[model samples]
Target: MSKIIALSGTKNGVISIRKINEPYGPGSGTVASVGISLSGESENPEWKVHIPLDNLDEVIKALSELK
Candidate 1:
């Protein structure tokens, strides 16, 4: 797994994009995932979104289509 990017939020938090293992087993067909995670203080829960490596291209395209 590799990290694509890491950025600090203006308010208070850390955001990162990384390559991670697929949540399901390897047999699930997707071996890797490009995901986003946001981490904050102990009082706040973190959030994450993991896009399968295979679907990354489409996902990126769709998001980029937005303003």
Candidate 2:
């Protein structure tokens, strides 16, 4: 099983952020960064941003500007 951490929305509450931790083999893999977008229609598909674990800081900065 993988681990995920959710991020809060800004503004009134539109989008959310999620951090994915995927384990593969004996520490031979890495974790991924993903974003769950909820700003579209109720039936709209969620967007996934595949980012390397090393760019976690970038994700945080991007999420901070969301509303």
Candidate 3:
């Protein structure tokens, strides 16, 4: 008799991108990356996206492409 094994694909996670106010206050001229937890699993995945605080348009474009 032969045994069959199941195959599965695992995902490391996804990088979540979102808008946020200026870190210092509410101005602009800065770029930052932060890790966001996506899954509700015990080991919350760590993800981040590079966004220009000055130009949100670029961020929007990148997000659109992702979709």
lDDT of 3 by residue, 1-67 (tens): 1111221343443333334456456775455444444442312335455456656678768879998
Residue pairs with backbone atoms closer than 3 Å in model 3 (clashes):
none
User: lDDT tens digits, residues 1-67, model 2?
Assistant: 2333333663322333334455444654355534454553212326655566787778769989894
Q: Taking the tens digit of each residue's C-alpha lDDT, what string does model 1 give over 6-64? A: 44553445454545454577765443333333543322326556677788888889989
Backbone Cα, N, C clashes tallied per candidate: 0, 0, 0
User: On a 0 to 100 scale, what is the lDDT of residue 6 in model 2?
Assistant: 34
* Residue 40 lDDT (model 2): 36
Give the candidate number with the greatest TM-score. Answer: 1
Model 2, residue pairs in steric clash: none
With candidate 2 superimposed using the best TM-score fit, by how many Å does residue 63's alpha carbon deviate from the native? Answer: 1.1
Worst 10 residues of 3 by lDDT: 1-10
